[model samples]
Structures are given as C-alpha cells and as structure tokens.
Target: MVYQGNDPKSNDNYRAVFGASSAPFVTLLEELPDEKRNLRYSLFCDNLFTSFHLLAHFKQLGYEVTDTMRENRIPKNCPIAMKKKNRGSRIFIRP
Candidate 1:
C-alpha cells in the first residue's frame, strides 16, 4: 500500500500520473502486477474513491466496479431518486 503525505510535494508523482480525481485509488489499481492488471477483476470501493469518471474509466477497462457514492457525486442528469425520498432502497443506473 502507498502512503500519501498531506504535503503537496510528496504527492507530485501521483498528481503527475493521474492529474486529478481519485488518484490514490487509481494508483493502487494501476500499480498491480502485470498478471493481475491484465485479468478482469471486480473492484469495490467506498464513497471517498467513487466518482462517475472513475467508474467509467474502470468499466472501459473491463473491470466490474461497485461502490457507494455521495449524493453530490451523482451526475446532475441522472434519474436516480433522491436519497431522502427513497431511504433503504436500491437504485441502479446503466449507461
């Protein structure tokens, strides 16, 4: 596992590679050994690492991804019901 320092200088390589958006998560996945990286894998992550862009990126790479996402991270155009309106319910969105 990689340790990320709070200071900006310590994360320069991560920033350079991923630019922005869930770099820590992306870094871990990308750093997998070649055999693991080439095989299809299911990735499960928490809200802190979940975003529409990250989901799409892994989906395109043939990995099955599942995660809990913050309400704010939901795309504005998505039709999922608001959390308050559908407590304990499951909502699925397909692209």
Candidate 2:
C-alpha cells in the first residue's frame, strides 16, 4: 500500500510516496476504524516490522501479534529458541 501524504484515508497516491520515517505497520494501523482500534485481533506481520517497539504498539492497539525477528533486533541475552522448541510459540517481554 502506498502512503498518500495529503489524503491518508485512501491508499491511492497522485505519484510519489511521502511519509514520515515510520514503521509501515504504523501507517497501516493508523487507518483502523475507531471502534475496532480497541478490539483484540491476531496480527501477522513481516520481518521488517518485527521489533520491540512495534510489538508494544500492537499490544497497546489491542493486537496479539506474531512475527519473526532479525537477530540484531533481539537482545543478545534473550534466546528465542529456548523459548520455543517449535513454531507458534511466542514470548512477550514488556519494553
């Protein structure tokens, strides 16, 4: 989806994509319906969006989010493997 600077309500762009240097998910989340914003939902996002900040933001926005992380985004001491022996297991650490 493209970011429409002057008209955010629509994803259509006149030409160029102009937006704040923000997580792409942040821009997408901003378009949520007001009431649904407070409802809990399971969200699946790409690796580019998997970060502590995004996780916290998703939680605050009432989402149970799932995503894989790049090693650097994780703290050195935290072992993601030990937390899960297989897929679908999640560890939520409060920032």
lDDT scores for all predictions? 0.72, 0.60
Question: Model 1, which residues run further than 4 Å from truth?
Answer: 1-21, 84-86, 93-95
Model 2 clashes, total count: 0
Please give the lDDT score for candidate 1: 0.72
How do the residues 2-54 of candidate 1 rate in per-residue lDDT, one tens digit apiece? 53644343356655553455776766777789898889888877887788778
Which clashing pairs does model 1 show?
none
- The CA lDDT at 19 in model 2 is 22
Residue pairs whose backbone atoms clash in candidate 2 = none
Instruction: Rate residue 7 of model 2 by lDDT.
Output: 44
What is the lDDT for 76 in model 1? 85
